[model samples]
Target: MKVGLIGFGKTGKAVATAILDNNELCLEWVLRKRTLLEHRSVPEFLGIQSDEPGLIYSSLTTSMEELLDKHPVDAIIDFSSDQGIYTYGEIAAKRGITIISAVSHYGEQEREFLKELAKQTVVFWSPNITLGVNYLLIASKFLKKIAPWVDIQIVEEHFREKAGVSGTAIKIAKVLDLEESDINSVRAGGIEGRHEVIFGFPYQTVRLIHESISREAFGNGVIFVAQNLAGKEKGLYNFESLLLPYFYN
Candidate 1:
């Protein structure tokens, strides 16, 4: 797959590494807000130095216009903020490119925008891309159907400087038909991520927890979704739908 990356943060670098390790995946180019000097390359932005033969050292550009015009890619994976993905989505839609957005904390407007974007090109929006968490969303639904009397609460922990409650917590809450108040958030200790769903009952309690060992979990998700989404039809898809087999099998 010829893939363009839209961010160069921690998770972005992890995904890039995964792509570098995969023979079928190619890192075509990366788009960022700031341009680096001639002394640096895309790897500098990703904080990775390429050592493997045949690995692609992609070019870096600040202009999305130039990229869309010149460097055509099979799909673009974005790990940036919501606004960056928002603008990129508009252009990607017009160019008929697939976009995998993992931007967190989307508002009503962003949600509406993605819906329209999907009409133009295939788009997968995921706040948390871990396979296990996607399974949790489905599990929450089954648990509710089997035990409606059980009260469920969510607790999500992230790094201390993390902003707002995690979208994973919100997604899980939505799956269980619970309000935001039912979620507990902890932002501390430079943790990657962890989520626990507790089912409370008078007679018994059940806890389902998923703790990310590292950001590689998300990189794995990127590969999984990218492989499945290539050349697919235009549609707004999420993690739950991608992992629907977990519920059946």
Candidate 2:
């Protein structure tokens, strides 16, 4: 699959590197906000040997239309901001390109926009796209279903620099039918990311934990989504939705 990447920050770079390394996926180009490394191939920047173009382009210089027209891709994996979709969502949808977005947050308006785009092409979005995180969420839900009276506590830990509550924790709470206030956030020294769901029963406590060791986990999650998403019907899908099938009896 030919892939276009939006966003080239730390996580974005990791996702691009993962794509470049995958034999089934091709890193076509990357679009970012700045022009600092414009036109530099991703392989050159990462110092890994690969033949894919993986060129970097700045949104300041290149319009989304120009980029898509010149370097068409089968899918676009976005680690960009919530507003990044506005740039290429419609264009890519109209052309039937798949979109996999790992943006951390999106309001109701952006979500509605994704639903609209799904009418034209496949669209998948996840606030926390790591496989382990989504798996933890699904398993927690299953546990809750089996034991509805258990007390559930969610705690999320992240780097100290990240202010406010963790979005992934909020998502976990929602999936388990808890309010945002039910989540506990802990900010500490350079923690990549960790989410723990504690289910307290009368006799014992079951904890489900997922820790992101590196940003490369995001890349791996995107690859898993892209591979499974092939030939799916057009619709808006969350990471859990893509993973739910595995738990079927």
Which candidate number maximizes lDDT? 2
Query: Relative to the unseen true structure, what is the C-alpha lDDT of residue 183 in candidate 2, on a scale of 0 to 100?
Result: 90
Runs in model 1 deviating more than 4 A are 37-39, 42-61
lDDT of 2 by residue, 52-147 (tens): 999999999999889999999999999989999999999999999999999989999999999999999999999988999999988999999999
Candidate 2: minimum summed lDDT over ten consecutive residues — where?
Answer: 240-249
Q: Which pairs of residues collide in model 1? A: none
The top-ranked prediction according to TM-score is 2
Clashes of each: 0, 0
- Candidate 1 lDDT, tens digit per residue, 1-249? 788877766787787777666667777776655543322455554466654322222235235676666667878888888887765778888888888998877888888989999999999989887788887778878889999988888999999998888888998888788999999999889888999999998989989999998787887888889987766788999877677755578
**lDDT per model vs. reference:** 0.78, 0.93
Instruction: State how far residue 82 of model 1 sits from its true place (Å).
Output: 1.1
